[model samples]
Target: MAVTLRTAILDDIAPVGHLHHRSRRSAYQGMVPDAALDTYGADAAARWWVERWSHERDTHRLTVAEHQGRLIGFTYVGPHEDGEPATGELYAIHVDPGHQGRGVGRALIRDALDTMRERRCRRAVLWVYAANHRARDFYEAGGWRPDGVGRDGWLGPVPTPQLRYALDLTVAAAEPATPAAAQG
Candidate 1:
């Protein structure tokens, strides 16, 4: 089974929201209170995505990954949070729990980096829950490293700490040693 990656369209926003809800619940279990996960249901997620995408479509990129006829994952990329020129930020990448560990995430990140590169970005950065060892390991394995920056962020009503991880897009895209380039 192959996962297909494509630029997300209006029709995909709803599904992206639904998948995001599930992926968040699964990935953030125990990290955040259950109430935090339950605060926003799938419908809310869909609406939120629709609203956000409507405003950001021009400056941001949203991509969906499909397995067969179903959307299994998505990735969102845009300018850096602080508006750093030439720096792109991967705001989110979520894979359905059932579909994870099957290359969906790897594909999404690669596509995200490609999108950033197309945006003329030389650097890529993302924030991850500091306690999420699995996600941290996954990104580290892909050549992303913590840049020693941490921030307190909120998930629903819960406050959490996150670490900023960065990757030199030019190096990863051009270096054969990078996992992303190896896939190419």
Candidate 2:
């Protein structure tokens, strides 16, 4: 099935939340404690998304990838809170486990990059768990590089190390906006 990308609406909150919960659970299984993962339930995620979407809809861009009629992946982009005016952040990206290894994640990331470029962002940054090589590889393949910066963070109750990844959007923006159909 062909995947389509579109801006997320209020109606997508639940499914996006569900995907977020599932993705985190699967991706952070060994990194985060099982109890902490259990605490990140669909309800909490849905409420968080609802609040964020309601409060920052204008400043943040939420895009989802759908196959047929079901949303299988999503990405969030916004101004980096700790960055300069021209720096954007790839806040989050989640793909349903069922859709993993497909092109959904790559498409969602491309859409977010295009959106950031449209916003005149010159750079983008994201943070990933230092232990998550899978995620690190994905970001690296997408042209993001670690800035040699890391920090201690809490994923629920467990403290973990996180690495910051940076991308030069000025170069990415110069490229065509078409999303590549590559596996992520």
Every candidate's lDDT: 0.85, 0.80
Candidate 1 TM-score over all chains jointly: 0.92
Q: Which 10-residue window in model 2 sums to the lowest lDDT? A: 175-184
Over 4 Å off in model 2, which ranges?
Answer: 173-184
State in Å the error of residue 151, model 2. 2.5
Deviating ranges (above 4 Å) for candidate 1: 173-184
Task: Write model 2 residue lDDT over 129-182, tens digit each, in one string.
Answer: 889878877787777889998888776788878888889987753222223222
- Give TM-scores for every candidate, taking all chains together and pairing residue i with residue i: 0.92, 0.91
Q: Candidate 2 at residue 62, lDDT?
A: 90
Range of the 10 consecutive residues with the lowest summed lDDT in candidate 1: 175-184
Best by TM-score: 1
